[model samples]
Target chain A: MGSGLLVETYVFVLAVFVGFQLISKVPSVLHTPLMSATNAIHGIVLVAALTLAASVRTPGGIWVAAGAVFLATLNVVGGFVVTDRILGMFRSTKRSE
Target chain B: MNTVIQLLYLLTAVFFMLGVMRLRSPATARSGNQLAALGMAIALAATLWANHRFAGGALIALAALLGLVVGSAAALKVRMTAMPQMVALFNGMGGGAAALVAAGDWVARGPGGAAGAIAALFTVLVGSVSFSGSLIAFLKLQEWIQGRPIVYPGQKAVSLLLLLVDLAAGVALAAGNLGQGPTPMGLYSLLALLLGIQVVLPIGGADMPVVISLLNAMTGLAAAASGFLLQNQVLIIAGALVGASGTILTQQMSRAMNRPLSNILFGAFGQLRTEGGQAVEGTVQSATVEDVATLLAYARRVIIVPGYGLAVARAQQEVRQLMDKLLQRNVDVRFAIHPVAGRMPGHMNVLLAEADVPYDRLYEMEVINPEFAQTDVALVIGANDVTNPAARTQPSSPLYGMPILNVDQAAHIVVLKRSMNPGFAGVDNPLYLNPKTQMLFGDAKASLTQLLKALDEV
Candidate 1:
């Protein structure tokens, strides 16, 4: 709710919009790699949520922060775990008839 | 404290931009991934430093360690052939996470926090639905579930009623009407479960790619809603990008199949067939490996077209070997790849790549379609629907107006299929009856190996 926080939020929003615009122009061939990298950003969110939960003083802010941290952590870890399991389905071994 | 976090946010944004830029080519994709990863790390570190949360350090570390082990195993073990399934599962996880975030917020704050409560409820609803829908898609693609559409009496009525109930719940939650009563979390979760089942139940095999794209878009929207609840600008922007792109991809896929989006959702074209309805009338010609090998050995130019059948049979290596043998005989061999080939986009290319097929030899549908006329032999390895000429010539066919490989234009066509069954679109192919086309019925790998031996005799 502070002015400094407002400015930070604005700058962050602008940067993200710019980032989206840049990626929109990328061709299809590069999508996989791009996605893999963006996926890691979930980790950053997890850390931020945890830190905020521990330090923030507002009533119930800790719970909010904790919940955010948990979700972000799940996004980061669960994404890759599921991806690997799905990938295993494609392994084709020769079946003798 | 704010200044440092702000700087970290800006840095994360820049890395995201650079990552997107690097995605323009496969050659730089790895570097792009690294850049995004670095950006995420910076943002996380800065946020943590600003808040200085240390109570759960040990727990977080343990979780991180487990993640690293599981992630590495998946990355190292997953085959390229199953990339779509992998994508679906990841999308589901992302959506599930977003939904859980919303659910957690709602349960903790109750209805007094109206704005947060509503946002959380909406995200949970959408995210959960997307998550379950995507999981079904994964099963369908993996063949763990039937590829054919499932329909029962009054299915449409049930789906419509479910949608109505889901909407009503959303409206009630948004109005902040449950302050003194028990939360409708149970109802909302049930609606989400039904929505998932309803959406995926009617989708047939041929429409899996389109369904995947649509679910992907839903997940993105759910993420954006969760971001709104958290008031995170970066999450909103990224989520919006994904949602928009996914929607566009779904549209394109629908257009490519020459079907309207509504047709895909409600018509359920491939789910059932009229009893005893026979395929379109056409002459059937059969061939042996020696016959196919003789044609290939004597031909100066050959074009190989692959489909889902090839992937199902795991025949990429044999096909590659056949190409190698043809190359030894000084034959000109090129692969004709359809844009919507196999079960998903780029499916054939990935399978072929695993077999170490030369990249230069693979040609997209647009580029190679015209050359089919000049080709001496169009060797279709386990492909059916995409190569069907009926799409181009038949106006009433379900697949009419769709783009297809011009293999029928070639001098001679050899089609390898397991049976005379129709493709996923549930339409008989006239190409199968063409005079120039010869059907070599069997498993793709087995047929290719047989043909290889017969070629040796020739």
Candidate 2:
């Protein structure tokens, strides 16, 4: 069990390094969208919500997990959709105002 | 079969990583977001398939579908000025979800053991903090709550005491594994939530972007702790990626503004520095829209500096109209955008781009600073503190050492402001008092409309 945590720690550390390197290179012009994208990415917690939903037996636990699923879905859906909408406006074409 | 599902999850994680890398440029960013969405679908499918036999299937599906519709509508309908609040709202939901997941895990499984207890408790504490903190941030950004730094006597002391108590409660609940009526778990979560509100309350004004980014990072870390509780590889990876990236980006934003990360967070810049008493000796010159139009009409080159006011007044389109007329008159026109010009980095860019302001015409501070000297007219619109020359010279000024757009260097300066009221930082600007600077007062949009009509007559 301890070894499992150690392995997860290894993965966590390496992922931090990867994220730092990748995001540091993105220009400040896109930092707003970059924040939105990362916000969407962490919505991966939806997986936890789904897994908990299946196993939770208590009525209270099920209700709690249901709420988690709802919020997680919102984070995933709203985050990516808003980010796409913003980035869509960044066209290079010179349109007359 | 389980191993296969884990492998698929890992593969999808690669998609997420690739998606983030694609954000390096605007050209590929839309496709990049699509790829990440694809990854999310795969991950969700893998989990749904894996957990098919688990209970509460009908309820989960209902919640997910309901969330999908509401989330989409909100995203599609929110106006650009409200973008910061929208992001804050979504971020708060993520943090709240992680905390609830952790809380449910503890209640359902009785912490599973020591390792589980630690992970679950950690997620519960941090996630709740991020949840409540982001909500307060949302209210402040939405202007539902006052944007001023809400401080009470001994605010710092209260925050410190609460934090210490929170940690102690977390330790006791974990070590003792106190399984009883109401549970210390609820107390822990409650304290953490209060701690979240305390954390964000004293932060106000131009410091919001950094706060939002930091809260984003906090939520990411909370999500990561939930990953540890669930033993989920993808959650671990994605959460860590967001946590780390959000942190680095926060520091970079502070650096871009030439301020320390700590100062940005704790300095409470607007509250600490009221407008300084030693005022400049020069008289304030007020000009009319006609005077500005004549100045612009005769100018060879003009640089326009935009600020939060432009965003507040929704004047980007009118500003765009002005720019088109200037170009039609054979007067060169460009926009000078300070990095922290709006509530968030790139806010002004998005607003201008929405109004069809060409990206090529928007010059960042570094590129546009030198050109101001050669320009015949510098049009300052709703921008105040960023143009304050004190940042460059005055040692006692709160804005001192923060990089500013050098609109003062232009041969002629016309400022469009509501009044002589100082900018958000409460630091009086010497630039407005300069002999060459003339303030043209009123709402930014109204003045722009008048200026446009005056330009036609000129």
Most accurate candidate by DockQ: 2
- Candidate 1 chain B weakest lDDT stretch, 10 residues: B177-186
Residue range B371-454, candidate 1, lDDT tens digits: 999999999887777887878877767678889999999999999999988877767888888989999999999999999999
State, as a TM-score between 0 and 1, how close model 1 is to the true structure.
Answer: 0.85
CAPRI-wise, candidate 2 is: medium
lDDT of 2 by residue, B364-396 (tens): 889999999999999998888889999898888
The segments of candidate 2 whose C-alpha lies over 4 angstroms from its true place after superposition are A93-97, B180-182, B272-277
What TM-scores result for chain A when each predicted structure is judged separately against the true chain A?
0.48, 0.92
DockQ, all models = 0.18, 0.78
lDDT of 2 at B135: 93
Please count the clashing residue pairs in each candidate, in the order shown: 0, 0
